[model samples]
Every structure is written in structure tokens, then in C-alpha cells.
Target: MNHSPDTGTFQVIHAYTRAEAIGDGVLVDVTDTAREAGYLLPVAMTSAAWAEAVAWDETNRALQDEAGRLWDVLWMARPAAARTGFGQTRIAFDVLRVPNHPAATEPHRVTLHVHIGPGDDGHAVLTVLLAHED
Candidate 1:
């Protein structure tokens, strides 16, 4: 993605990479003007912090990609409900092996929440809450 050299804060993530990471099922406009696909990290996140978040033992890009694939499966399974109103679902990911932290030895549970609702136009909006566990 060619992140900015400054690894302190405000690392510039290419919009295309983010979009590809999310998947090709939906189109996201990431331009400054559109801002439809804005990347909103937790308020306290600096570039270094973001790096740590991605490099964490339990949760990382691979897990996120798995969750996205799972979401596609979930969407296909709810075709009947999707015809009328909103359909929401969630799945838990048991952080495998390697424990959750550098010291801890037990696995932790991370949940991915999916919200499928009607979009502004004729399309649909698929919102995935990547960090919601409960």
C-alpha cells in the first residue's frame, strides 16, 4: 500500500488497498470529496499504534480477511430475509493458538458483527463491525 514514510501518525493508506481488503462485493468511494469509505480508527491510534494493532498476535489482516469471507457466506444464507427488511448477524472468531497476548496463554474470542440494510439508492449497505465482541 506504500504507507507514508512517517510511521508516527496519519499514515496514508491507499484507498484502493483498503477497498480490496474489504472485498469486491460492494463499491466504496474513498476520495476526499466522497468519503464514503473513510477509514476511522480509534481516536488514540497513531501510525505506530495502528501497526501494533495489525501485528497483534490474535487479530490481524488474515483474520479480517477470513471474517470477510465468512460474511459472504452469511449473506448468501439470508436471501429470503434480505428481500424485505434489514438482516443482522454475527459470528465469533476464537483467536487461535499463540494466545491473545505476548504473555497470556489462553485464547480470546473476537466477534464480527454484520449489518445488511438498504442503501441510499437501489444498492445495499453491508456494514461489518470488526471489533464488536458482544
Candidate 2:
């Protein structure tokens, strides 16, 4: 796993893999202006074969795998802020905390949005967005 900041949002780039039949993953420790908002280990992968193993309910395992992974993002994300479209899906998770900074007036609410889609070669593409609510 490798990550960089995209604008104000923290972005993570990952390649999915299986070791001994278990999925490899990441744990993100997000922070607000005041303090830590806790952590999330988002599940992701690149191949349809891996998706098939994880998406047990899909008959069309390839397509189902994409949706299933998107669902995983949705599980941790805020429902009112989520969006799904042609070839792509986006979801946000809110981190809760009260800001104690001297210059701060509002509680810091960190929102994490996960964007997912299919690459040109049909592999999965995932992008993560982290932002604070003013």
C-alpha cells in the first residue's frame, strides 16, 4: 500500500492481493483538527478472481465482485453522502470529535469518501478522499 495527499484529501493507492486465500488490506488512521478519529481497514482488490472468492452471493461473480467491493466502502460510509454511477461508486465516512483548538469554534467532523471504478483493462480502481467539515 502507498499513499499521498491529493489537494487537502489524503489518498491511498493499493493493489489487491490474496495470500494463502485471504485478502491483503490496509488500516487508515484518520484525524480531525482536534484529535484522532480512529481507523478503518478498507477492503480492496484488482482481479475478478479475487472478487469471486469474496462475493459469495453473486452468480455473475465478475460483476458482483465489483458491486460487492463497492458495498464494502458503503458499509463504512455515510448513506446520505454516497453516490454510485456508471462504472464508478463513491461513499463517505464521517469521523466525530469536538475541536479543542484555541482557534476552533466547531466540532471537527472528518469525512472520508471512497471512489471506486473499473480501469481500462477491467481491473478495479479505488481512490480515497478525506476532508473536514467546516
Candidate 3:
């Protein structure tokens, strides 16, 4: 994805109540509109910050992806009770830091930490952090 340049310094911001999912079996209903909010960060940062942000994003993606896979496995293991009715789930993410750069004078990289869990209302919630580094 590409980011526009900005003059402000970038910082990690929390993306509360981002993605969502519901349903059972292999046919899970998922939505990722929350991911779009992450791009709102600044667009330039220091080299160190940029590297850190990139690392954070990489780690975050891996963790979230793995969690999703695990969820799939769990769903498949269930017989019927867990498959019928509505199964609640959630995912959360946290942004680490923002990078700085002289060329852009803002942070362009964004890092996110994601978590998935079951919601109280028989639904799934996804938590995610959106950070931008320059």
C-alpha cells in the first residue's frame, strides 16, 4: 500500500473495534474495514523509526494470520453445538511506533499488533493498532 506525504510527526494510534467476523464452519463472515483506518498516519520518519515500524507490521501480520488459521482449525474441530447458533469472536491490534525521515518530514510506515477473541454478544471482535512511520 502507498501513503501520502505529510509534515507532522507520526505516532502509533490505537484502532479500537476494527475488524469483525461471525458465523460457523469454514464459511466465516469476515470484514476488514478497520484496516483502512491505519493508513491515516503521517508519511515520513527517521530511518530507525521506519525500520522499527516495518518490523512491527511484519510481526503483527504474522501473529494475526496465525490466529486466523488457528480459529479455522478450532471451528473445524467442533461437532455441532459450536457450529450451530452464533459463535462470538474478536480481534484486536496495537500500533508500536512511528518512524521519522528528512525527505518527508513525517512518518510513513505503520505497525499493528492484532488480537482476536469472542465477544459477549455472540459475535467476533478484532482489535488492531494502526501506526505510521516515516
Candidate 4:
């Protein structure tokens, strides 16, 4: 079926929200940490980004910490967010991340995309997702 964009007519179906994603582990809310890092808006990371950049276990404790890793991700995002646009909706950024792979010996470049959009309640929010993710 073809739907017109101008027509304010649409059927309510399955609506997955940011809150629900965080609650369901699909998205990890990092707004607190972001604020600590000097961010003014709410921020979140996709499950994939969390797994690759934020997840830390005792196995990797000797080499890295979750806080440091998370900080690195946010640190890189800072300049990228600013360099691209002042108030753009979408921005693509890259960060060097030490993957959670046991075989990984060095940091690899990972592309992360940031989308600034309306929150569940109409507030501005940011969602960081893997390059291939929506």
C-alpha cells in the first residue's frame, strides 16, 4: 500500500521506543556518563556498540577497564559531533576500539553513527549505533 507523507494518516502498530530498548537491553543508556563527560543531551549506545566498546570482564581487566573504554568512545564522539554539524540530525564518526575478541591484540577502527532525534517524550536525544545499524 502507498501512503502519502503529507497526509497525517497512519495505523498504530508495533512501536518500539528508546525507553523500551534500554529496558530490554537493546540499547544501553549512557546519558549519565555522557553528562559526566560534559554532554548536554541524553545519549545512548546500541547493544552492538556496547558489546564492542563498553563491555568489560575480569578477563580483560588487566588490559582495560569499562570506564576507560567508555570514556574513549565518548571522547572520540565529542569532536566528531562538533566537527560535522552544530545541530545536524545524523553524523558519522569513527573510533578506535579494542574489540572484545580474545584474539584481538590491537585497537581496530570502528565506525559509529550518531543520530539526534526526538526522544520518547519529544526531547532531543542521541543514539550511537554501529555503522551498519539503523
TM-score: which candidate is best? 4
TM-score of each: 0.27, 0.27, 0.21, 0.84
lDDT by residue (1-134, candidate 3, tens digit) is: 23335845555464222122122221122233222223221111222322333323333323423234323322322322122234432122323233323333233323332323344443543332223410
Candidate 4: segments with Cα more than 4 A from true spot: 1-8, 83-87
Model 3 lDDT at residue 8: 52
| Reference-based TM-score, model 3 | 0.21
1-134, model 4: which lDDT tens digit per residue? 34558996776667899999999999999999999999888999999988877787757524887888889889888766565446567787887877776666588888888788888999888888888888
Ranking under lDDT, best-scoring first? 4, 2, 1, 3
Candidate 1 lDDT for residue 116 = 44
Score residue 131 of candidate 2 by CA lDDT. Answer: 35
Over 1-134, each residue of candidate 1 has an lDDT whose tens digit, in order, gives: 45555674465464443245335523322222212223221111112212222224444323443233333323332342234343333322222322224565443443333344433443444433344322
Model 2 regions more than 4 Å off: 1-75, 78-82, 86-88, 97-107, 119-121, 132-134
Model 3: residues >4 Å from true position, as ranges? 1-104, 108-110, 130-134
Q: How well does model 4 score by local distance difference test? A: 0.82
In the order shown, the candidates' Cα RMSDs to the true structure are: 14.8, 17.6, 18.5, 2.9
What is candidate 4's CA lDDT for residue 11?
A: 60
Q: Could you tell me the lDDT of residue 27 within candidate 1?
A: 34
How much is the lDDT of residue 119 in candidate 3?
Answer: 42
Candidate with maximal lDDT: 4
Q: How much lDDT does each candidate structure score?
A: 0.33, 0.37, 0.29, 0.82
Report the Cα lDDT for residue 76, model 2: 50
